[model samples]
Target: MKIAILGTRGIPNYYGGFEQFAEFFSVYLAEKGHDVYCYNSHNHKYQEKTFHGVNLIHKHDPEYKFGTFGQFIYDFNCIMDSRKRNFDIILQLGYTSNSVWFFLMPKKSINIINMDGLEWKRSKYSKPVQQFLKLAEWLAAKSGDYLVSDSLGIKKFLLEKYKKESTYIAYGAYPFNSPNEDILKEYQVEKENFNMIMARFEPENNLDMVLEGVALNSEDKTPILVVGNHNTKYGEYLKNKFKPHENIRFMGGIYNLQHLNNLRYYSKLYFHGHSVGGTNPSLLEAMASQALIAAHNNDFNKGVLKENAFYFSNPTEVKNLLNNSKKSNNLPFIKNNYEAIVNEFNWTKINGDYLQLFEQCMERYKAGKSK
Candidate 1:
């Protein structure tokens, strides 16, 4: 099968979850003898023509120069380039920027879109922007040949809201048992002596609430490390607000996978505050690292963690959980999460599922054409 993956910064995973997905999925598909092509931005540092067995195609991305509006132009360029490729299938990772150009997609290819988390519901966007996102969602739903939901919660949402059925396929993660204690020394933190929160410092992620909870429960001598791109306005506000509590350390964006895994594995507790998104990569990674989690109470997290995690709704609940820290006693819960990752979120299984889905879509497309 000739497949083209779009809607990400590209393969080496310099960016976030989508890029990581593209990297692993593209490589997996290529290994399975599928001709997989991944689209990269012009500004991405990697200049390679191919990664692993997957082909790489670079397109002009103006986001660096034109800001938010540039994303649409970038997606447009990708779609335009894709029209000439004659791919059998085009996998769009998200529709936020490209849904408007669905009409431009090649008629010869089957377009299967992964309708990522509810972008219109995110608190960061203004009302008008949210409305526009809603329209984009509708356009993608109408234009695509198939839809994939990363979580069951999201699958139900599309069914109920858009009257559209979507395939449920969660993200994947590898378990991390080996931890380098030496890595902790570089950050001046000891193993299991600190708690951690790793996420984008955004409003929808509930970073402010998590910080409040950590600050409120500062009686413990253990430090709380916050890792992300905390250079934004909200990040500065959280820093100033929580600076009085010396126990909370704002460790800005550590992209090194090994280092990040070590931090998560050795943490006394890991907080996952994402209220949106389906099967978040960070949450899965934390579980794989055997970190005792305190996730924001939401359907998305509950669907993944089930009875295997400590849930908190508000800052007070988070603080209370910290004050009465009995995470060690919940060894079974931690083990359950790890088992879930191995059983349900394995990368090998996910890649196979994607391949099967593509085949199914192709069969259906052929059947429709014959009719």
Candidate 2:
């Protein structure tokens, strides 16, 4: 199959979850003898023409200059290039900016869109932008040849909202086997001696709420580490608000996978505050690292963690969890989460699932053409 993956900044995962998915899935597809192409932003750090066996196509992305609006231009460029490729499958990772060009998609290609999450529900966007996003979601659902959902919750959503049946294919993660305890010394923390949360500082993510929980539980004196870039306006505000809590340490954006894995493995309790996404990569990584998780109380997180994680709905719940954390036996939760990664959420299985879905789509397409 000739497949082109778009909607991410690029492969080799310089950015977020979808980029990570692109990097792994593209390489896997390439290794399986399918001609796979991953589109990259012209400004992406990795300027190479190929990664592993996967082909890389670089297009101009002016997000640096025009901010969020630049994404629309980038998606347009990618779609324009994709029309020339004559791909068998065009795997769009998200539809936030790309749905507008659905009309321009290659005629010969079967477009399979990964309906990411309830993106319109994000608190970051204004009312108009959110409404626009909802329209885009509908457009992508109507336009795509098939839809893929990363979680069962999202699949149910598509079914209820658009009467569309979407294939549920969650993101993947590998189990963390290498644990270097010495790395903790650099951060002035000991193994399981501190709590931690790693997420983009966003309102919807409930980063502030998580911090507030820590602040409310301040008397317990359990040190908590806040990881991710604190350079954003919201991030800075969080820093200033939480600075008075001496137990809370804000570690800026960390790019190293090994370091992140190590941190997750060593942390006493890992808080996952992402409230909107479906099968977020970070949540899987935390589970893989055997981190004791306290995720946001939502269908998305609950669907992934099930009864295997500690669920928190608000700052009060977070406070209560931290206060009694030591009394909780984390072994069963750790065991269950690790098994999930190994058995279900591993990259090999996920890549195979994609292959199976693509083959099914191809068969259906062929049947339609024969008719």
Candidate 3:
């Protein structure tokens, strides 16, 4: 099968979840004898024409100069180029910026869109922008040959809200067993002596609430390390607000996966505050590392963690958990989460599922054409 993956910054992921998914999924498909091509931004540092046996196609991405509006241009370029490639299938990771171009997608390629979280519900967007996103979501739903939901909750949401049926395929994570204790020394932190929160500092992610909870418990000698890109306006706001708390450390964006996994593996607690997305990669990584989790209480997080992890909604709830928290009490839950990753969320299983879905889409497309 000739497959084209779009709607991401591209492989050799220096970015977030979608890029990581592209990297892993493309490589996996390529290894299984499928011809896979991934679209990359021209600005991407990796200039290689091929990465891990998957073809890389670089296109103009004006996001650097034009800001948010530039993404639509990039997506247009990709879609227009994909029309000529005559791909068997096109897997679009998200529809926020590119859904408007669904009409331009090649008729030959079966479009399978992974409808991500409720983007219109994000607090960061204005009411008008939110309405536009709702329109985009509708366009994407109507245009795609097939739809994919990363969470069962999201699948249910599409059914109720849009009367759209979608395949439920959650994100994948690899278990982390080996930990480099020396990496902790580099960060000036001891093993199991710190609580951690690693996520983009966004309003919807609830970073402010996590910081507030940590600040209120500053008397605890064990520090709470916050890891992510802290250069954004929201990040700076949280930094300034929590500047007085010595125990709350802001370790800005560490991309080193080994070191990051070691930090998660050794942490006394891992706080996942993502309220919108389904099966967040970071949350899965924390679970894979067997970290004691205190996640934001929502259907999305609840669907993944179930009754095996701690839940919190506000700063007070976070504070209460922190006050009563113990590593020993969370041991069973941590073990259960690790097993869940191996059994349900492992990349091998996820990759296989995607391949099967692709085959099913191809068969259905052929059958429809014959009819």
Candidate 4:
């Protein structure tokens, strides 16, 4: 099948989860003898001339911030190129691309969109932006021939709000073999000695809560290393507010996979504070790295980890958990949970789920029901 992946920041996964999905899918699909094309931004530093035996199309995005207008440019360029090149299916990842919907009038290709999460509900956006995002999401759901939600929580949201059916397929992380002693020493962390939290510094992710929890549990010697990009205002604020505390270390984003794995492998506990979105890639990578899992206690988290992780809803609960003598970092429960993740979150299996979903959408399109 000729498939095109649309509406992402770009490939090589330098940004976030959607790019990772695109990268994995492109490689996997190419291996399966399917023609895969990924839309990329020319401004990306990792912009490749080619990748993974799959075709790469660079969409020139003039805007730097990459909001609504940026999406318009990307979609317009991608859709125009796709029309000339032709494709069996077009898979979209972001909602701001209403141009794809407008072009759907004439052609009836299989349009499957992987709706990552509810961008409207994120704490970063203002009221007007949120409302606009909500409208964009609705249009995206209605436009797609098939909707794919990364988490069951998101699928439930779509069903409740739009009364529309969506396929649930969570993002998967690249697995790393065991790290060496030298690698661990490089990160200045011993195995099971420091807690790690890797995520974008956003309000919805509750970065402040994690900092507060660390502050409250300051008596403990176990340091919490927060790894992320601190370039944004929110990130700068978080770094400023939390850096004063000795228990927390704000290590800026580490791009190297081996170095990242060095941190993930040596950490005693993985703290996921994201209250929004699906199963985060970093959290999945931490689980895959055999790290003990502790996340913000919420139904979305519970749904993803399925009672296999320690949960803390508030700073008090988090501090209490840290103080508890019974909560050993390398407990059997944690080990077993990591084992389960190693078995479950493999990229091969996760990508296969997407392949199947695309096939289903193609079949539907062939049956002339895509509209």
Q: TM-score for all predictions? A: 0.97, 0.97, 0.96, 0.91
Give the poorly placed runs of model 3, Cα more than 4 Å off. none
Can you write out model 4's per-residue Cα lDDT over 1-371, one digit (the tens) per residue? Answer: 98888888778777777888888889899999998889888787776667887788888876577665777776777777777767888888867654345554227467777777778889788899888888888887777778888788989998998888998887776666667757767667777678888888898887788778778876787888888887999988887787768768888888887777777776777788888876777777777676667789877788767777788888887777666624354467556656656666677778888889888777766676645
Task: Enumerate residue pairs that collide in model 4.
Answer: none
List the candidate 2 regions with Cα displacement exceeding 4 Å: none
Q: Give candidate 2's whole-model lDDT.
A: 0.91
What is the C-alpha lDDT profile of model 1 across 1-371, one tens digit per residue?
99999999887998788999999999999988999999999889898999999999999999999988999999999999998989999999999999999889999999999999999998778999999999999999888889999999999999998899999989999989888899998999987788899888888788888878877776776798999988988899999988888888999989888999999888888999999878899999999998999999999999999989888988899888787766678889889999999999999889889899999999998899999
1-371: candidate 3 lDDT, tens digit per residue: 99999999988998888998899999999998999999999989899999989999999999999998999999999999999999999999999999999889999899999998899989878899999999999999989889999998899998998899999998999999997898999888888888999988889898899878877776776788999989988888988998888888899999888999999988888999999967788999999988999999999999999998899988988888888888887788999999999999999999889899999999998899999
Superposed by TM-score, candidate 4 places the C-alpha of residue 90 at a distance from the truth, in angstroms, of 0.5
Note the Cα lDDT for every prediction shown. Answer: 0.91, 0.91, 0.91, 0.77
**Model 4, residue 36: C-alpha shift (Å):** 1.9
